[model samples]
Target: MSEIEQLLRPELRGRTPYGAPQLDVDVRLNTNESSYPVPDAVVRAVSAELADELSGLNRYPDREFTALRTALADYLATQAGVSFDPEQLWAGNGSNEVLQHLVQAFGGPERTALGFTPAYSMHPIITETLGTRWVDGQRDAQTFDLTVESAVEQAGEVDPNLVFLCSPNNPTGSALPFEVIEAMLDAAPRALVVVDEAYAEFARPGTPTALSLLADHPRLVVTRTMSKAFTLAGGRLGYLAAAPGIIDALRLVRLPYHLSTPTQTVARIALEHADLLLETVEAIKAQRDRIVAELTALGLAPVPSDANFVLFGGLADAPATWQALLDDGVLVRDVGIAHHLRVTAGTPQETSRFLAAMSRLVPAHMMTKENP
Candidate 1:
């Protein structure tokens, strides 16, 4: 390592960086992005706005993001079915930036950030980037569910300052149960519980959102995005719902001019046509069901998922499997955890392409292990 690399934030010296694939495949199911395109109406609006943009480029963006914040607060309120004052809201380029602001505000030498493993891989990377130690609660290797007993034990053991729970947890599409969340709330009342509901819109009717529990849990913060079910991955908009105090802290840490005008306009239009976009979400959910059913028939053990992607391990020689799929113009993700692989739901044609690729890659023995 170079001398500078050695001296660099000691914790970050050799950490592997997050690497997203740079390819175009027939079925690009690696990242958990919606395969749907923006509604033609919204795309035209975005284009028109871009055309109308000021040539001045001299005046900085609205420093306070005042108008954008108002629009976002109103829109998310309807989507979440929860009320939030404008003072209780803020937006960033993406939820990832919002998360970083939280770390900058709270994570430091002694403060710890807590979460579960096999989470959004970005979680640990973000914690390490802030020089904060990451403490995680264990899960059943077979099923990625957390128990109240285990969560409480970790709270006492690690004493983390911030705890993140990704409901409809990423990579593995399991939703952290309400009981488990209640137990963690009981266990770590002092810690900030960040319930990341990035895929909440895909959740079934009875599943409760962090917003539902906020009435009783003051320290809870729920961050959501328009990228998943809203089909706005390219929009770069994410929001948070928390108590006034926590929101105030985030407001203090973030840059003055954050959410851009185009982002605000597009997000507003997306929210307006949500019922239409929800058709896409329903289609994706149906697509996920078909994929899961097919995966099971092919003898892969996909964990029950409430999100867009499903995960399974025991995939035969994962790198070889991945390469095999690549050869056939079908690509998927081999997130390193034994034979673990994650695949996203896409349009029917995309789904068929992925299934054909799977037929080409998986061997008999690994298929047996995945099933039995």
Candidate 2:
């Protein structure tokens, strides 16, 4: 080990890092990216704003982001079906960074960060990097969800300083019930509960959102992003809705002038055409439905997803199937969980392309019952 590695904490240096797959293919469904391009109208609006604002790049961007922050809070309040104050708002480059900020502010070597396993890989990454202890609740794979009983039990054991929950969770794509989240709140009312809604837009209605309980729970912090369903993945905009006190602490740690003028302008412009973005969201929902139905027809069991992607397993076919898709110029995620693969709900054309590739691998007999 290098001297720096030696100087570093011994426990952390042994941690295994998260890995993202890099595939060589045309139809890329590895990342849960919305295949729909931004609407023509949004593109033009962003261009108009960029033209008006780009000249100011030489000057520093807004440190407070007064207008952009207000707009974010207002729009999120309306969309999340909750009331929010601008003072309760915070923004960062992405929710990944925003989450890092949370761990940094609330976590320490002595304090533990609590979360469930098989979640958005970033959760464990941030917790460990901050040198905070990680207390993980167990998962229920048979039901493909987490039980509130498990969450509460684990929280009581660790008495962690923070709890992270992802609705319609990453990788697995299952939505935890609101009651489960509330039970978790009851268990650890003192610890901050960060509900990551990165894939919130894609979740079907009636699914639970943490925003509704934010008013009653002072320790709640809800983080969201414009990257997934918003079609501005490259824009790098993430925001958090937390109590004013939490917002103030994060603001204190924030690097001055964090958001660039272009980022702020583009996010605002994107918000203006909310209707246009919802259309793409609707299409993804439809595409997701089709993907699930078709995968079942092929005798592949995909966990019912409330988000923009689905996770399925075909132990017999996983490796060969993944390689087959790649050979046929399609790319999908092999997330290292044996026999399981994650596929994004892309546009109709993209779905069709994937179907074409998959049909070639799934055999004729397995169309009714999974071949052992």
Candidate 2, residues 1-372, lDDT tens digits: the string is 889889877877767766556666788888887788888899999999899888889999988888888888778867876878788888888788899889989987788888887888899889888888887666886655788788888888878789999987988888888887888888986798999989998888788688888888889998989888898777888989989999888876777888888888888888888778767888888988899999888777788888899888764657667777888888888776767788999978889999877777776313234565
Stretches of model 2 off by over 4 angstroms after superposition? 2-19, 22-24, 364-372
Against the unseen true structure, what C-alpha lDDT does each candidate score?
0.77, 0.83
Specify the highest-lDDT model's number.
2
- Model 2: lDDT equals 0.83
Least lDDT summed over 10 consecutive residues: which range in candidate 1?
A: 363-372
- How far does residue 343 in candidate 1 sit from its true spot (Å)? 0.4
Clash totals in order:
0, 0
TM-score (C-alpha) between model 1 and the true structure: 0.93
Per-residue alpha-carbon lDDT of candidate 1 for residues 19-62, written as tens digits (9 for 90 to 100): 87969766688878889887787677667766676563455676
| TM-score of each model, in listed order | 0.93, 0.93
